[model samples]
Target: MSKILIISAVFAPEPVVSAKLSEDIANELALDYQVVVIAPKPTRPFGFDLQKDENNQTIYRLQNLDSYVFPESKLLGRLKESYSFGLACKKYISQNRKNIDLIYMNSWPIFSQYLIVKTAQKYKIKVVTHVQDVYPESLSNKIPRLSFILRFVFLPIDKFVLKNSFKIIAISNKMKTYLAKTRTLSESKIEVVQNWQNEASFTSYKQKENQDRRIFTYMYLGNIGPVAGVDLIIEAFAQASIPKSKLIIAGSGSKKEELKTFVVKSKIVNVEFLEVPDGKVPEIQGSADVMLLPIKKGAASSSIPSKLPAYMFSKKPIIGSLDIDSATAKVIVESNCGWVVEAENVAELANKMKLSFKSTKGSLLEKGENGFEYAMKNLSKKNNLSQVTNIIKNALL
Candidate 1:
């Protein structure tokens, strides 16, 4: 059997994007491969809890590993955590090197890839790096001084790993291009494989009671991260003219406090924020009249938010505030399932919100139907799994 070792920062039970992607890929690969994951045990972002791993079997079998303090917490903590993760991964690889064929890992906890590469070298194993989000540059670009440090410290190492890898998977074309220019990666080394959603599970559902009382329920579901343009949504939603329309922003992240501050200062009576249980996304998201997907103006447009397929499957009209070149924008335009707003144009976003609230539900529903059809045809997880397996097979051969 082909033996593959997967390393990631998150896995099942966490409900984060990295976890979902890792779990899905491993599960799919298990059909014809022996997959063992090595993932950092889950912990509260602030606290250090080691006991959480003892309670969950699903998380344990899938390769549970020690959790180190997050880097952003402190300089020493970051260095210690990076070293510990690298060492822990090295120790694990030492024990199982003979059984594994290839090492695969995602980008966040950027240093984890270091372990994968080091261990791969020790065992003469192949390596594949998954670029979930544009990294080093992403972290550094958001903080300019760090840009200099990351360009020197992180970017070169990232490029080295990618160059040595047998294949580097990019989530979007733009990501592929950017990585190529930044890293000077060989054109043949990069592969574009857009993340697919579990469409079967995203099927349209019956609208729940009280769904009609709200003028238009505009929802922004998923992580409230800096790159997602949640601040833009908040600013635009705060000044939106649709007094009866309600904007429900769900999920939590580093930006939650800032959002709360905006809500308090703007006194946007029509907007509400909720700490949504990860499992409750379907019900919460499905209740919305429209789903919002916004990307920050200057952020990498290569990413198509994981929420798009869910929005499509939810059968809700989407309002994407992204550049025309973004994968999300292209999908929305081609599917004719939603409207696109300029990334930084708050006025345009507000107008879209007003227009969306006033638009006929039938036309919106029709657009959603078209989107669902397009998704069904092009973005099924099953199809994606097949494609991924093919890539792995080709790489291995």
Candidate 2:
């Protein structure tokens, strides 16, 4: 069997979206190809040691400043970590060039993806680039003052990599359209392979007949970052007039403490913050009366959150605060799984929350079932895995 080297900035044990997806990809490919994963050591809030699985696939974890659970969130520290991982990955590929037949990578830590893709091209190895999130676009949105300069410098580099790769896999059609328009690449060169969640991992927890109907729980699970619109969620929850409803913020990130402080200072009594216990995500999701999926307005065009599938699998209606035209909003609307409100509009969000709380259990269950059926039919793990593996096989041929 030919060898396939997979590179990602994060991997299993990290509790990040990229990590889970990358781990699943490696395991799936291992059954047909010799697979090796190159990643940085697992760190924070889920610090798991480097591990190698029984399939004999090797995992090479390089040293970086992210040795601790929460590294300094400075720009320089992030660059150092990215460059270090890039250098380590390049060295490994250089030494093992003759043994590797294909390179599979995600768009993360931009420098690492650039280094590995450039190196693979030089060595005449086949490469499949998975476009998880649009880079300079995401970067530009975050720093408006430097947007022009960042795009000027990085767009060409991004074009070069995408142009030379054997195939570009976009996680969403919106992403593919963005790349095609901005990078001037052929739409045919990019294929859509939406992310999938393991349905089995999210078995629905049936509520008891006597379960409390007095309190409605609205849950938000995932990173608490700027782009996540978490502050908006908190503000809306605080303003909503649902006295019997509770908002659960279960996850960690740079803004976790800031958010907690905000709640304390504002005396927001209806919202609660909790750490998600390992292996309890499904149960937690199932217990909620409604799920909150919020994204900042500007970021809606380039990426879709990896949490959507899991949310759907939990069989609960969603209250999505996102760009009305965003792919995320499109999914929620098309599936008829939930309601959508303008992102960042605190008043609108508050009204939506109140509406969800007043919704009958039967109505919520119907919407949740719609989402679950959509997920099972279109975002099934088995289908997505097979699709990705076939794309890799075709690229190798």
Candidate 3:
């Protein structure tokens, strides 16, 4: 059996942002390959201690990277922490390289990729880099000086790794185009494996429950991060004067307090932001009549929110505030699964929101039903695993 080692900076049992996708792919790959995962321990937003070693043991292999530089970092603390994590990973991999045949690293801390690159080269193992967000495209433009430093040092290394890697998996087509522009690699070396949802997560199918509710509820699940366009969605919902309609925004983030401040300052009465209980994301989604996916303009090309599959699973019509050409927009429009609007366009979003609520009484339910059917037909975890396995097979050839 091929032994594959997966490295991620953040992971399971903590409800951390990237864990779901990492865990899902790792678990799926485990069906065919022996999988081992490396991840950091949990901490608070401002870096406080939390439950350690309590992560969900089912899906993740869970090796704790113990360094205070991580969960304790403020401002440039992540840079310091990630550098340490990279060093630790390199040391760990160097010591344990004999057991692994291939390496796959998720990019966020970016240093994880760096460690994989270093170790894979030493061990002469194939390495695949899975990008959830684009680097220079997102962060480079945000902070120019830092971006210059990154472009000077990291970007070239990233390009080298991408070119030399056995495979590069992009979460979106736009990201693939971006990488293709910079890297001299065969088209076959690059693949777009969009994010996926677990088939079992759709518990609605397993045991029937009454989904019929009187109130026309709209829900937004996932991070309250700025890039997610949570503020814009609230503004749009504020403008939407639809009576008796409640909007529930679930999940937490760095901007949670700031977003709460905005709601309080603006007196947006209809919108409620709740800290959703971990693993109960479906419970919140199922409670809604419709779902809203709002992404701000100029966020990042790797902007296909992972929540898309969850929204689709909810079987509620989604009104996505994403650019027309964006990955999420393509998914919504192509699947005929939901509606897409330009980011931060409150008027347009409000209009679509009103329309979804008004129209779902009749054929709108049919639209949601269509979305669920499409999700089952196309976006199942099995299909994702098949795609990943096919890519691995092709790369091996």
Candidate 4:
């Protein structure tokens, strides 16, 4: 079997979208190919761990890196982590060049990605890049202080790596188009494969009775990190102050404590914070009446959140606070499953919350059905995963 190397920033034990994707792809590919993975030990949401970690297998090479966890070192720390992981990948590839048939990387951009690709080329190894979020521009949302100057330097290195990669998998068409146009790359170079979630996982969602006695509940699940705009969600929910309605913010990230502080200080009575243990996704999702999808300004131009598929699969209406032209906003409109307000606009978000709260049960259910139908037709996991694995197999043949 041809050996494939999977280099990711995080892996299975890390309970995040990217880590799950990395795990799925690795296990799937392992059936027909010799698969090896190079990833940091579980360290994202601060508390996840893999206790029985073994490093002796030739099929697995896990690394211990200096990556910062949530509520810890912010920007400079991430840069250090990225550089640190990049060196790990580079060293491994340099030592195992003859054994690696191809590399599939879902990792931090600019530093980590560049170093791996640059070194891989020396030995004629092909790399397939999985694009999650567009960087440099997205950096403006993360670290505005140096984005302007850094873009000038980062762009060229970015262009070189992407342009040299054997294949690029962009999660949405809007992102694919944006990359092609802005980077002056060939249209055929990038393929669109959504970071698909397993529909079967949600099939277990039963028609359960609502646990909360509130008239309506809105939920924001997943990371509470910088780009999540979770702060915006908290503020909007507080401002809406809808009677008989409550907001549930679930999952972990860097911004949790600050958001908790904001909620308490603002005297937001109806909002709640949670630490969602694994295996409770369907239950947590099935409880909500509407899904709150909020992204900060300029951040949604290139990518869709991994949560969108889950929200849609749960048959819940979404109220997206995203850019008008963003891929995510377009999906919400086209599916007619939710409402879209201006990204980062507190007033607009509040108004939409009120509107959704007042919507009739029939109207909300109809919207939920619309989103489920859309996910079925467009985001099928089997089809998308086959596309990804085929891209890898054909690259070698």
Highest lDDT: which candidate? 4
Candidate 3 wrongly placed segments (more than 4 Å): 31-33, 43-60, 68-75, 141-153, 203-214, 300-303, 390-397
Q: Candidate 3 overall Cα lDDT vs. reference? A: 0.72
Worst 10-residue lDDT window for candidate 4 reads: 47-56
Runs of candidate 2 exceeding 4 Å displacement: 44-74, 204-210
Select the stronger candidate by lDDT from 1 and 4. 4
Q: After superposition, how far is residue 295 of candidate 1 from its true place, in Å?
A: 2.2
Error of 2 at 344 (Å): 0.6
Give me the overall lDDT of model 1. Answer: 0.75
Give the better candidate number (2 or 3) by lDDT: 2
User: What's model 2's TM-score?
Assistant: 0.92
- 10 residues in a row with least lDDT, candidate 3: 44-53
Ranking by lDDT: 4, 2, 1, 3
TM-score of each: 0.89, 0.92, 0.87, 0.93
For 1-397, candidate 1 gives per-residue lDDT tens digits of: 8788888766666656666778787877777778888876564232212233355444214766675746233445655676677777888889989888987777344576776686787678888788877767666646777778877887767776787788888888888988899889886888888788776556545547445765678899877767678888878887785767788988766677788888888777778887766456667877788899988765656777778887887888999998878778989999999999888799999899888887887888898898888878766786766776667767777
**Reference-based lDDT, residue 52, model 1:** 36
What are the lDDT figures for the candidates, one per model? Answer: 0.75, 0.79, 0.72, 0.83
Please give the TM-score that candidate 3 achieves against the real structure. Answer: 0.87
Tell me how many residue pairs clash in candidate 1. 0
Tell me the deviation in Å of residue 297 in model 2.
1.7
Error of 2 at 277 (Å): 2.7
